[model samples]
Target chain A: AQSVTQLDSQVPVFEEAPVELRCNYSSSVSVYLFWYVQYPNQGLQLLLKYLSGSTLVKGINGFEAEFNKSQTSFHLRKPSVHISDTAEYFCAVSDRNSGYALNFGKGTSLLVTP
Target chain B: DTAVSQTPKYLVTQMGNDKSIKCEQNLGHDTMYWYKQDSKKFLKIMFSYNNKELIINETVPNRFSPKSPDKAHLNLHINSLELGDSAVYFCASVDRTNNSPLHFGNGTRLTVT
Candidate 1:
């Protein structure tokens, strides 16, 4: 079984401040990692994904994440945050051996204040 | 154009009632799924269908049933809905490939009163 852990439930940061949302996962086999953002009353939008290749992955809205294999972590980061970036972020993982069922973390609510 | 769309974005009904949420995907994807997000914002997979065939069915109660008449449409029907059945149900679709990201609908917020 594969599971994802989002370390923080809520993160408040001032606008233009750098922020990081931590995520960790455990799986018996190789897994695909993804980050999705959900605005208020909206559905999830893909932010980034780590299938293979480079450990560092860039995504929309100037967000990025690094996949750490040894530590089993994939943390999302942004040099500067905007008030519009406030949303609920979810980290999900899918076992490569299995089908398309994605195991998702509880979620991290990012509240950016202006 | 909307990639994935679900009807009745907000649903409020009495307990023990029966209701259905309809979902359609225009992305021509062969695989679709139903996910439920509870009040705490935890998203869990309930059912998945690929090429109109049931592929993944989680430990969901028999009260919840998913039907796919075709690859482009997947609908969910709940029987004898209880108070605990209230949650935001999201419909999503993805390509046949495993690496493709899911395209999600706005979601149907079901409130059991």
Candidate 2:
């Protein structure tokens, strides 16, 4: 079984400020990583994914994540964020062991202020 | 058009009542799943179906059953609902053929009183 741990449960930042949401995972074998965002009263949307390619993966809304195999981390980062970026972000992992079903982390709430 | 859609966006029922949530996907994907989101925003996979066949069934109780008449539709029926069952249920689909990302529906908020 695989597990995801989001170091920070809540992140508060101001508009135009850079932010990084930390995520770490533990798995016996190589795995695929993903970040999904959920706005208020909405479904989860894929932000980015790392699938055996370049360590740095770019996603929508100018968001990006880097897969560090040694550290077992795939943290999401944005150079500058907007107010609309406030949402709950989740880090998920998947592999053949779990039949490719994504195992999601608890989630981190990102609150962007004016 | 919505890729994945579920009906009864908001369901409020009393305990011991039975309710059903219907889900459909037009993406022609071969796999569909049911996920539960708790108040704290944690998500847990409940069930998954592929090509109208039940593929994955988590440790969920038998009181909760998932029926897939076809590959494009999956419905969840909860019998004898409890207060603990109050949460948002999301229906998602994915193209298992190619390692595509999962597409999710808006979700159905189930409120048990």
Candidate 3:
């Protein structure tokens, strides 16, 4: 089984400030990791993913995440957050051999204040 | 154009009533999935279909059923609604591979009173 853990439930940061959201995972087998962002009343949009090869992955909206195999972590970071970046983010994992189900974390709400 | 779309963005129904949610994806992905998000923001996979074949069916109640007319559309039908069913349902699609990210539709909020 693959499970994702997002520690913070809510994160409030001022506009233009840097922010980082931590995510960890536990899997009995190799897994693929992903980060998705959901705006208010909107569906989720993929922010980025870490499949293989690169440890640091860049995504849309200037956000990025680094995959740490030793730590079993994939933490998302943005140098400067915009007010429009305020949204709820989810960390998800899928076992490479487990068919089609994706295990998602209880989302982390990010509030970008001006 | 919307890659994924779902009908009835907001649904308000009484308990014991039956309701259905429709989903379609224009992205032409062969695999589609249904996920539920509760009030606490926990997302759980309910069903998945690939090439109009059921691939993954979670431990969901028998009251919830999923039907795929084709590779591009998947609909969810609920037999008898309960207050616990008041949550957001999201439909997503992928290319039926391991590396691709899933595209999601704007969810349908079902409120069973």
lDDT per residue (tens digit) for residues B5-42 in model 3:
99989999999999999999998788999999999888
DockQ, per-model, please?
0.82, 0.79, 0.84
**Candidate 1 Cα deviation (angstroms), residue A39:** 0.7
Which regions in candidate 1 have their CA more than 4 angstroms from the true location?
Answer: none
Tens digits of lDDT, candidate 2, A1-114: 799999999999999999999999999988989999999999999999998879999999999999999999999999999999999999999887876778899999999999
Clashing pairs in 3: none
DockQ of 3: 0.84
Q: What docking class should model 3 receive?
A: high
Off by over 4 Å in 3: none
Task: Give the least accurate 10-residue stretch of model 1 chain A, judged by summed lDDT.
Answer: A94-103
The sequence of per-residue lDDT tens digits that candidate 1 reaches over residues B1-113 is 99999999999999999999999999989999999999999999999999999999999999999999999999999999999999999999988574688889999999999
lDDT by residue for model 3 (A56-93), tens: 99999999999999999999999999999999999998
Cα error, residue A98 of model 3, in Å, equals 2.9
Encode model 1's per-residue lDDT on A1-114: one tens digit a residue.
Answer: 888999999999999999999999999999889999999999999999998999999999999999999999999999999999999999999875557678899999999998
**Model 1 fnat value:** 0.77
Q: lDDT of all the models against the reference?
A: 0.95, 0.95, 0.92
